[model samples]
Target: MNEPGGSGGAEGVRLQKVLAGAGLGSRRACEELIAQGRVQVDGEVVREQGMRVDPTTVVLHVDGMRVQLDPDLVTIALHKPKGVVSSMHDEKGRPDLSGLVADRRVFHVGRLDADSEGLLLLTNDGELAHRLAHPSYEVTKTYVVTVEGRVKPGVGQALKRGIELDDGPVRVDAYTVLETSPRRSLVQVDLHEGRNRIVRRMFDAVGHPVTRLVRTRIGPVRLGQLKPGQTRVVAGNELGALMAAVDL
Candidate 1:
């Protein structure tokens, strides 16, 4: 196997050493992976050794999946509780996501209203956060909603077909009525847009105002078994898939 090219200066960490530090394996084992051309530095496959990369600025991938090398940059999935705001700071003095990651310099990717609850991501990686929240990426957000009154037939169809909100035409990627009673109905829906109170507005338009809302998933990451106010670091293969969603 031929030696890998350098990032030109001697200022950065060695690729194999960095890989080892990232828990891939012993330094020698990481070098073997490098020798086999399984390592990619900023999208280019590199082989052999002696390549130096700035983990802070350079992107690395093994087998076409992006790897996280910077310890400072992290993404967090927080199960926001009802009445908690998504912002890091709330002047109103209510509980907010800031207390959750007070030790890290992170910002929420999107907002979950004070009344809404469920999966919300916070990260210090600006590019990843921007892409994930951008409308063009269309990262679908899944939510379970309880609405007032029984859900009438064809409401799902009407939402699937698209409803014109005051902002514009809105449509759900998927919708299912989970349960219904005379006074309340439960349903789940998927959407990519993040307009202010979009889910609540959508239901209201259909004549069923949302009584309770809880997000369950965002793209491939699920809230899972996390209870209210719980949080987990988003890492490993799950992190890779998330970055891929935004073409990072």
Candidate 2:
């Protein structure tokens, strides 16, 4: 059975997560609402911590106010440009992504380094963000890399084998050659680990240092047709496709 605004699922989800997914507020903001004795489930105020609710059955109200659940979740795919950080806002007032998102509350699914450009996911669903960013999920990402030198034989094998980094071992799930030249080669590197600068380091270790890298895909969502600095909302089965790819 499906609740009026919640998905039909048997799994138990945190009240704060549901509220945040409902776009009432961020997860932390929902917690504050709960702590203040303002949230109600089935007509009873819930001040208890870590309250779990079935999204398919619970009738939730926040701040003694009834919140009509959002019918569709918001998911945006952004083609981030180099030099712009993935953060919502920068203290230095650099061109952050917040200005590009029309909604006030949407947040990036994960962090992308300022120098790297390509697909970036933005969503209002915190639980989805948690699933996508969690290391345990091992979300696969494909990057189109331009390296400074000709890729040696077994370089791709070296990436798959693993490279030692400051954090720990970083490895690619799969990779293949795209194009090659004397000074540069473009290879597609697929990685399960989402460590910072892992792809660059992996190539550097194998003697083919990456000069420019752009993430072309995250699971099934591609940075397709989206130019740099452009944004568009995802709809229909694209949401299911993405979540399924990340095993959410």
Candidate 3:
């Protein structure tokens, strides 16, 4: 394992690298912290990126808040209920995940629209969050969608084949019809795309506008019996699977 500072020694690690490893953000973003003079070493503001200090011995602070190396990498699964935004704050006074989880430092891995609900992963591990959110990883996300009108046979195939939206072409890896009725139909669609409202828009593009959307799974983790407005820690083999999915 790499030490907090590259190779433990009298000289500390690079400030930006230390900050990034601490889950603050990417190295470039951490560099901005140093440039903004918000980073401090031993109570002195450090605007230079080259400056290094031992995390164990030297006192470090950012924006007047003490910066400590978080030893525990926390990741939690939240069954976000509808009407709750995926963000930490909503300027319009809408509910958000911050209220559900005690740790405000952790952020949602991806986003579920305010109107959509289901399994949402929140974590303080910035690197893991970045890998999971990136399109290249192709992390599978399964959704249980309820659409208006009974979906025709060809619709599922069409979705699997691919559809061109305003942004670009989108397609589902798998499509399954779980239930069907004259007025409504329930379908399970699996895809790796993480665009905003991609599932809803995909069905809408196929002329079957979605009535309700709920994410059932992400990678190896499932929503399972988790009820609305509930959260649980992701650990054990489940967390291991998630880490494996992203090649962590």
Best by lDDT: 1
Candidate 2 stretches greater than 4 Å from native: 1-69, 246-248
Highest TM-score: which candidate?
A: 1
Candidate 3 lDDT by residue in tens digits, 194-245 = 9999999999998888889999999989999999988887764576578768
True-structure lDDT of candidate 2: 0.78
* Total backbone collisions for each predicted model: 0, 0, 0
Error of 2 at 29 (Å): 39
What would the per-residue lDDT of candidate 1 be over residues 45-151, giving only the tens digit for each residue? 88848888777777878766678887888999999999998778889899888787767788999888999999999899998999998999999999999999999
lDDT of 2 by residue, 1-248 (tens): 53333333545787888878876678998889889988778778878657677776676766444443446457789999999998998999888998778565788987788888999999887777888998887788889989987787788887788878777888788989999888999999888777778888778778888888899888778889999989887653466567655554
**lDDT values for all models:** 0.88, 0.78, 0.84
Worst 10 residues of 1 by lDDT: 1-10
In model 3, what is the error at residue 103, expressed in angstroms?
3.7
The TM-score, computed over Cα atoms with residue i paired to residue i, of candidate 3 is 0.72
The superposed Cα distance between candidate 2 and the true structure at residue 148, in angstroms, equals 0.3
Best-first order by TM-score: 1, 3, 2
Could you tell which candidate, 1 or 2, scores higher by lDDT? 1
